[model samples]
Target chain A: MEAWVRKLVTGCLLTLPVAASAVAASEQAVRVAVIGNSPPMSYVDESGKLTGFNVEMAHALCATMKIRCNLLPTSLDKVVDAVSAGEMDFAVVSLLATPERRKKVLFSKPYYRSLSIWLSKPSIKPGSPRTTVAVVNGSVQAQHAENQGWKTKRVTNHREISTSLVAGDADATVVPMLTAVSLMEKPSLQALGLESTVLSDPLISGDVCISIHPGRPELREQIDAALDEIKRDGRFDRINSQFLPFRLL
Target chain B: MFTTSRTPDNYRHKLGAGVLLCRLTAVFSIVFASAAAWLAVDQHALLENMEDLQSRTLPNSMEHQRLARNLEVLRLEGERVLAADNPENRRQALFIVTLMAGHPSLLANEKARNLAIETEIFLTRAAQGSRIDENIRDEWTRISRHLSLTADDISVDGINLAREDVRQMNGLVEQTRQKLHGAVALVLGFLALLLLLIRRMILRPLQQIDHALSDLRQPGSAVTLPNYSLRELASVREAIVQLHGLMQEHESTRDDLQKLAATDVLTSLNNRRHFMFLAESELTRAQRYGRPISIGLADLDHFKHINDIHGHAAGDLALKAFADIIRSTLRHSDIAGRYGGEEFAFVFPETTPQEAVALAERLRAHLDAWVIPLKNGGHIRLTTSIGIADASAQALEDALRLADEALYQAKASGRNRTIQAKTTQLPLPLGGHTDNSGHSA
Candidate 1:
């Protein structure tokens, strides 16, 4: 009975977006969620400003579309829910589109492709269920690790995967090779005999597209068109060259 | 005899059927094998691209994405740590921070790890305070925020890697398609060339053989068979030519064999069967025209003694000598034969008993004077006994019997003598023409 009441309340909260839509014509700022966790694409700088490829691209797109942009910092697990519940318009989450997520949101055109990676000591093999992987909580790595039948040491932050590996809470850590570049360059990793390998798989790695609210199908088209415009203008390439050693688009 | 050469022009290195087949097989194999090998290489390259995607880039991108989300969660937890005043908030924040800071990248790093450590220490000490210190909270925020940024960088890199994999796959597919097209073209070309080779090597030569056959079939048609480019065709033509030569030779040999069949091989005389045929014709003519004809039989005397002394070779020499003497004494119209071993018969057409007796005496005189040289450094003289009979009214067999009886009488009277049979009208079998074709021996 309590569950039914909560469901009713949540359902009503979902309809609140219709009222918001009524005021949307008055140039109401588009609320955009940014996970701000991925770097070079979306992350906070040392200046405590959300500045990365994704952040800059969003600003560029908003400026071109002549729309006022309101940025929202959201976690990866909550970004989908926040946007789905009409609390946000869209999210700049960098994960590739998956069939499961497609059921909830419309995905913008792919901004870039990505690779998954494994970090482990040379003497230790990283596969098999016996091996525990340090994965971020509520992330694809967690799902992938569990799907492999391998135990995962779930962490709250990207840094925790490395910390978990050092603490021997996990036999290895799985992340993108780019994010772990600094960790891999550390002399201590060498002292620890840890090496990183890029894990290439179609199922887990591919184009990273922006996820849009399903209620805003037009927003997905607009974003996709804007993405094409930025690429044509060389803005996407310029940002990619500045941050990465390889092309993303 | 068949004339052969060590390197017959017929069996030269003309385009042989076996060589043509081998070349065809070789060309076909090369085309198909190269095609198969190319396909295998293309498939292998594509498989490599797929393996790379499966094993490395995909897994890495997936992991980084998870880590990126986790870092934001960590930052949210950090804010929670600062905002909450209750012991529950502090306790949860401390547990999360404590677990995260345990990783080597967090603790071992100089800048980020130190802040994470200070935050952990401050949170652990928060039991003494009501809320997290504002200054420590700021530092914790920076630490988590910076870690979040690192997660974003990793995701970008993963995305780039995945893009590279797809690009490589697209290129491989294009290359394979182009190579496949080339292979297809090569196969079609080989088939066309094979058709051409069949015309030059197989089909054309067969038509030549057909023409050669037509030429051979027509009589008086000049047979002009040229050497073929293909060895099998040339060989067939050569066999046909040789067969033609053999046929011509066989025709002439048949005529020679017919003549040899009626003539004696050793004495070169009309053999007994042929001699009787001519004698019978002569008797029929004499009987019909009321003309005279005589039959005579002769034998070499002391012939067994000569064989015992000088072997069958000497006896043969004696018979041949007797035949030569008869051949010399008789006219072309007369017929003579070695009737048996050391024995002979003669038919003198248009001759009476006296005329035959004269001819027989001449033959006797020649035999009496003839000498045969022996291989054993010796010499031998031969003589023969003869008898004549008038056969103007008698059948061939009766006449031959009368002459044989008179020949026996001459042998009894003395060897090497001639005698005449009394003109006998003795009754005998009429129209007696029983064939006596056999070796008189």
Candidate 2:
């Protein structure tokens, strides 16, 4: 019996570090990215905490995967670069998984769809010298607008797009449907004579997938399975109903 | 139905062809109905999508089509601004362009929203006391035509989206067809499996039962019983087993009754009637095969005198001793029977007349030495007189008559002797114990 106990002790000692390392790996903090000022999609609350559809979805996905996540607020333009560079494990922001972006990063199954829209007043024509359409710098909409040879005033975030329109620096801005909805929610922006026109352009695929870190295909599969799990369990619908007026799925 | 070695207890539990067919029909019906329902639902969804495109997307495109038409008029108005046909044409052109630029399609298309927005701005500036110069006309013409092209592209995009929707509907139809084929294949496979089971469990067992019934008529041919899974077939097999047992019982009973009819109870030998039957048949076979055969009659010497001297019990004991001697002396081919009273008949097959005399002498000698014990401690020595005749060349009746005459001659000469009938008109003195000695009680 003494000899058996000694053998068991030796066996446990040999396997202890392997078990501990696995625990450590599971316990490691995964950095999740969120944009600063895309309301209802992701934005800072009054308490200076990031909380929105994307942040809540990230939390739910982490819960499904049973892992710890750290939501990091980043600029809208830097989400793709941060994830591709492995600085962030994944981003829950609404980024269209276009074919060009697939080369640099892996994408989960699309969580929702988006469309390009022009946010402006009905009387004031968009993209005038005085009413130049405001678009986020380094975004698909900005690229599409520049490629289409339209006059654009580049901004950094959704808040700036809304503010530049209200401040009279820009009279119109081409944004996604959700952001347009967000801006339209502000009666101040509406009272500022701002309206929205939804667009159907060939350049817009509208499929918003979770952009995962490049080279982490296993994590991508884990995220995809977790995403499907969340959708199946009604967590996705719950989040969609809480954040969006229209169904995302 | 098959009847073989099967348990009667739960044999009823096994599924028969009818039940199996019902279940197969149910499963097939369910599968067919499910496939139909699935396809119907998919077709309905496809139809609804097409309807959505027709009712919603198509009507929505009319708005864009109007926008395109409005842009063409705006471009013509820009041409009027460039023509300078009247000083008021510039203000009128600006008024027309501004109202047309406010159209939703102008702002909806990223490419054209800005072009129309900026053209409206330039026209406003020119209408506000600015000169309608070549640079202003050039800008107005360029922006208005570009916006017109952009409006046309937007309208066409709506139609292309509709075409894509129709293409997707086509894909759904193809997918539904594949599902239907899969369901059909599943149904066919299940039908084949059901048929195989019927052949194995039903048809094959029935065939084996049929073979067993046909084989039952041949004696000693083993009946190969079938193992039946179905209860009805098993009960049939059990009934067949009972029938086979009854046939065997009947055969054994027939054999027992025949034995009782032909055997003599007292002597454990054939009786006179059956003995005659056997003798006649043997004589016929001997004559046909050209084989020698003999007949003989033997009597105990002074059997009644023994009964008169020492009670009938001692006489019967003496007769039984004589029968024992006859039984011990006969060959396998020889037939012997008690022919009423003290007489016993014998048929010696494949035997010559001289051989018959030799065997009869041996029987007399065996009887002569035999002693019957009496209850009074008295012993009776017994003997028999035998008469033999060759029946190979004569009819059975003539042979018996000749043997009877020879027996009379032997009784005239003496008692306790064996005699051979004269078939060649001469006797070779074939009688044993034909001396002047008789029974001494």
Best by TM-score: 2
Best by lDDT: 2
Report the lDDT tens digits of candidate 1 across residue range B1-441.
444422556476577788878988997998799898988898999999998786667755654554454445456666666676654444445444544444333333354455556656665565446555677667666666676776677568668888999999999999999999999999999899889978876788678777867776555454467667777777787777766566566766886897697788889998888887778888898899999899999887777888887899888877777777787888988889868777788988899877888878877777677777777778898777787888998898988888888787677665566777866543122121221221121
- Which candidate number has the best DockQ? 1
Error of 1 at A225 (Å): 43
Chain B, per-candidate TM-score:
0.45, 0.71
Query: Taking the true A–B contacts (Cα pairs closer than 8 Å), what share appears in each candidate?
Result: 0.00, 0.00
Docking quality category of candidate 1 according to DockQ thresholds: incorrect
> What interface RMSD does each of the candidate structures achieve?
15.2, 13.8
lDDT score of residue A54 within candidate 1? 73
Poorly placed runs, candidate 2 (over 4 Å): A1-249, B1-156, B163-178, B185-189, B196-201, B218-229, B306-328, B372-379, B434-441
DockQ of model 2, rounded to 2 decimals = 0.01
Listed in order, each prediction's TM-score against the native is: 0.33, 0.51
